[model samples]
Target: MHHTTPPNTQLPFAQACENNQAPILAVLQTALQSSRHVLEIGSGTGQHSVYFAPRLPQLTWQTSDLTDNHPGIQAWHAAQTAPNLRAPLEFDLATSAWPTPADQPGFDAVFTSNTCHIVAWPLVQRMFELVGTHLPASGVFAIYGPFNYGGRFTSDSNQAFDAWLRQRDARSGLRDFEAVVALAKLHGMQLQRDEAMPANNRTLVFRKSLSQ
Candidate 1:
């Protein structure tokens, strides 16, 4: 999910992971406090997975991404000693079926960071569909990334970041917070909270309706 892919590196690294891990964890400690298992979409370099799993010892962290990113994820996983950390799963919301680990009934929570703005809009919707349908009732869904509020950028930096993302991939850009909330609602998720993150990013937390 981290955009900057280091070149010619034995173990891929994303500087943003180091910068935001603590803040993200602060939020997760409470948001996912009751979660038993978490499915991480777009694990990227797996830096976040490694850093977070050991800290959140209560839940099993499952890292996933497209197959090409597996090597980097494996590299990071290899260096970690967290028994709760699972290996990378080959996940592509656009193609691959939703993963259901044989060891568990299904994941109770879902977490993804810096991914919605990187993929096309349809894929983003597909991700929501999968999560909405597969996640158990009263599950958690937390996504971290830059988001526009009421069709307006939250800050000048986020505005510039949106422009850069579109320039890089016309199909990819900051998603509207309202639109995302609406989408989640359609999938039986209710907004729980929105936390401000560094660099104009936001972490949106939603809880699946108990009746879902």
Candidate 2:
């Protein structure tokens, strides 16, 4: 059945996405060599999934987000002809139980881009907890967004963006890199790679620790 479009306007399709997709894929190509099922959280305009799914045909891309965002995601999904791209699912990481059924083996990898800063800190922590629960011990979780390192903004633009975000919503702002890493550790995840992306953003890759 056809889905209605979401209310949010089309994002600018950031040049950063264009510039970084290849590099990000290069890393994923190696990191996800054995991974087949990938769950993408908070797929805003669905550009990354559309771009990556066709390139990695062996990997099934399952995109998800809050129900309100499903329509836009469907619109983007409709444009993709890749057989590996699945329909967008309704998911909210803050919730205790995932919307997906338990029978489904957890995702081989969980990916998200440009979302952490938009949500609150507790939600971010909860997201890691959910990721830890849904992913296998050796599975990967990758997040891409602007972030502050050592409690300082990495760039002036990011600082301005942080201010803008806070002005819009007091709790919305760029997160601290160290804090995220520490939280991930608490959930039995280890920081694997922290790559600097174009436009002052970063891609942080974490692996769920097998030791529990």
Candidate 3:
């Protein structure tokens, strides 16, 4: 059977996305079995949502980021047709009110990639608090990015990357893994899995507990 491929859509591409998507997918396939609605924070190029939505048709993927990122997200969403993929929306973690309705029961899972180090420390705290407020009890929250452990950089390359990030913005450097776990704990989530990824990055999964 002859098949015609769709023209490639030129949405902004993150090089790391190309390298890490497959491994991330492998982890997600296992972690997301019980999730029906996933809200992806900082959907950057929207590649992850587009890639995963089709593979896991059982889950509805909601992509969001700062308002500026919506265009690229829309472009990628438009290029593909998936019933489970919703249109991108504005979701600033630091804000008090999200664009989505307040009465909503919140997502079954929340996912973010390569965003923590790029945002300020306070925003990271806010992100976790918002996840606690917006996710149901026992819902999962997953973060994928480079992180420090025990006050040390994981690799020489991550050290250099940290230096580069600090040069751009003094606050824009990797965060400590333990600190993140502590933050999650304060907000009623427990660290579930910490999977090491290619190029010194890690995916941390946290599950909201019933106590909170």
Candidate 4:
């Protein structure tokens, strides 16, 4: 997908999003090929939505974030005119209500990035709970962020990052991969891939059981 820069005035921009969007799309190109609709959690600047929606034309992208991030997301959404992409919705994992429709099947895929380590641990758990509750059977859930494996930091950089996170908020820090997997399992999803992304981040793909 060719991503154009938003005019300097309106929306916010995250270099990290610009840096990582290509790699994330490389994976989602295949992972989300069959998906018709996707719910993006924590769409920081809506850069990913505009960048991805045009490329993956088959899927309708639904953007969501807390109320505070709406203007930037909306601005980005307005700047781009991908019919497949929806406007930003005010949805927070911990506070806002889930936008589930009783008559329709849930999202075909759920995507979130750089959120787990930022929110409190309980919110992460709650996020998974919402994923399990709203994702359709066999639906994909992709989460991208730095994560520890076997309760050990993957790199010294990640170690320092963790320390910085704790210093900022004692309740927030990188999550252990194993613990996260176990939590996903309890919620009826199974890990399908733990992709090593650029920098120290990972994009974990989990799929719900079709029988569930």
In order, the Cα lDDT scores of the candidates are: 0.91, 0.81, 0.86, 0.87
Tell me which residue pairs clash in candidate 3: none
Candidate 3 local Cα displacement, residue 70, angstroms: 1.0
Poorest stretch of ten by lDDT in candidate 4: 1-10
lDDT of 2 by residue, 103-175 (tens): 4556879888877898888888888888887788799988888889889998899999999999998988999
Residue range 160-179, candidate 4, lDDT tens digits = 99999999999999999999
Encode model 1's per-residue lDDT on 1-212: one tens digit a residue: 34465687578888888899999999999999999999999999899999999999999999999999998899888877699999988899789999988886589999999999999999999999999998888899999999998899889988888889999999999999999999999999999999999888889999999998
Write one digit per residue (lDDT tens) for candidate 3, span 1-212: 01122357467766678789999988888889899888898888888888989988878898888888788788888887688888777888777464463534468899999889999999998888888877788899999999999999989999999999999999789999999999999999999999999999999999999877
For candidate 3, give the lDDT of residue 207.
95
What's the candidate order when arranged by decreasing lDDT? 1, 4, 3, 2
Question: What's the candidate order when arranged by decreasing TM-score?
Answer: 1, 4, 3, 2
Against the correct fold, how does model 3 do in TM-score?
0.92
Q: Per the 3 Å backbone cut-off, how many clashing residue pairs does candidate 2 have?
A: 0
Give the candidate number with the greatest lDDT: 1
**What lDDT does candidate 2 reach at residue 102?**
54
Question: Between 1 and 3, whose lDDT is larger?
Answer: 1
Compare candidates 1 and 4 on TM-score and give the better one: 1
Q: Report clashes for each candidate as comma-separated counts.
A: 0, 0, 0, 0
Q: What are the runs in model 3 whose C-alpha is more than 4 Å off?
A: 1-9, 99-105
